[model samples]
Target: MEKKKLNHYDVAEVIDRFEINKVFDCFTLKNWLAIGTTNKLKPSHSEVLEEARQQLSIKWDEWNEEELKMNFVSMVIFVSQLDVPKHINTYFERKLSGKVNEISISVTVDCMLASPTYSGRPKNPYFFLQEFKRSLGDNHDPEGQMLAAMILSQKLNEDNEPLYGSWIQGRFWYFTTLTNKDYCVSKPFDATEPEDLLQIVYVLRKLKELILARVTP
Candidate 1:
């Protein structure tokens, strides 16, 4: 028999197989968003966010994953100062183990913002951004893929800290968190909205602060 090709949905199914306790039963969604706010972006951060918002307004639907990521999303991340401790790019494949099937899983993220270790490799992944084209229709599962990446990062996290992630399809951005096997996803925050864009930037800034605190000497 041929070996199966696993997509993100398969990975999610595998995660579902684990007997993890969900915290939503214990805590409200509002409390989750407030999990950590070590730092927030200043008003200056809005300058770049406005630029990205304008660029995305006209070009969002026209670009593919790379184009959207590089031209808009990456730009926003850079402006938000999330890339302070480490640079950002693609082409790295992360291999992970699944608890459900006891098989190896591999995934490549579109853009990963991480803190570098002493050797200068991506040591702690602070935030991940994934792109799923609306053009792909029902075939693409951006949320599933983001969840899978979070799951993989959770496994890689020596401290078992909560992982942060987001996915973009068209102009909408959806954020999520994975902690202690419990997953909590936020509602769609349209990139076109000024407040929504600011929130996204704020989250990135917070992640940067969190990473810096952990990695900085």
Candidate 2:
């Protein structure tokens, strides 16, 4: 049987066929996006962010996906300090696929953080972060790719926990949460804006707290 690539899916296909609901309560959305960025960054972290911000202001519209990841996205991920390099680490371009409700699904996660087994592989996935060069249009689908990875994460995990993921395009970053059949997407957090960039860092740090709080091994 031919397998379905998760990147091939868009938001509508995930909602229409898989029965996932996009409608979320206003409060819930606010709570998810409520990490405090105002007083959180140290001076050292601030220096790195300012550099990244400057680079982004100059080149956001000109870079492709790879350039974006290498320049801007990596800096954000670094300032986020996902976790110590001990056991938890981030992996890139990793392939994941599983059977969800009898339908075959697969995806290449652009970046994810998770605990590693002794053999050096992601044992329990924690979050997905993808960078998109194209805006929301027919040629690409950020939400669909995100949802597909999250759904695949659910199937592979089976831990009954909420999943976190995001789609980033130049200055705009949209965070998402999938818990059970309900999912929510936050308003775009613009990286060009200093405040929003801080919020973006906080959210990335927040993922670390979320993962460590989990009961799984």
Error of 2 at 21 (Å): 1.1
Alpha carbon lDDT of residue 134, candidate 2? Answer: 39
User: Can you tell me which runs of candidate 1 are displaced by over 4 Å?
Assistant: 1-15, 18-45, 86-101, 132-139, 214-217
For 1-217, candidate 1 gives per-residue lDDT tens digits of: 6544454454346456444444444232344345344545566766777887998898887888777776777767666765562443222334334432343456666667665666666665656677545344454577666666666666676677767777888888877777777766678888888878877776666666566666667
lDDT of model 1, residue 119: 65
Model 1: weakest 10-residue lDDT segment is 88-97
Residues 1-217 of candidate 2 have per-residue lDDT tens digits of 7654443577788776578888656444465567763547788989999998998888888888888888888888888888655557898888877878777777778898877878888877878887456366673677787788888788788888888889987689998888878888888989988988988888787667667767335
Backbone clash pairs in model 1 (N, Cα, C under 3 Å; residues 3+ apart or in different chains), count? 0
**Candidates in order: C-alpha RMSD to true structure:** 4.2, 2.5
Q: TM-score, each model? A: 0.75, 0.89
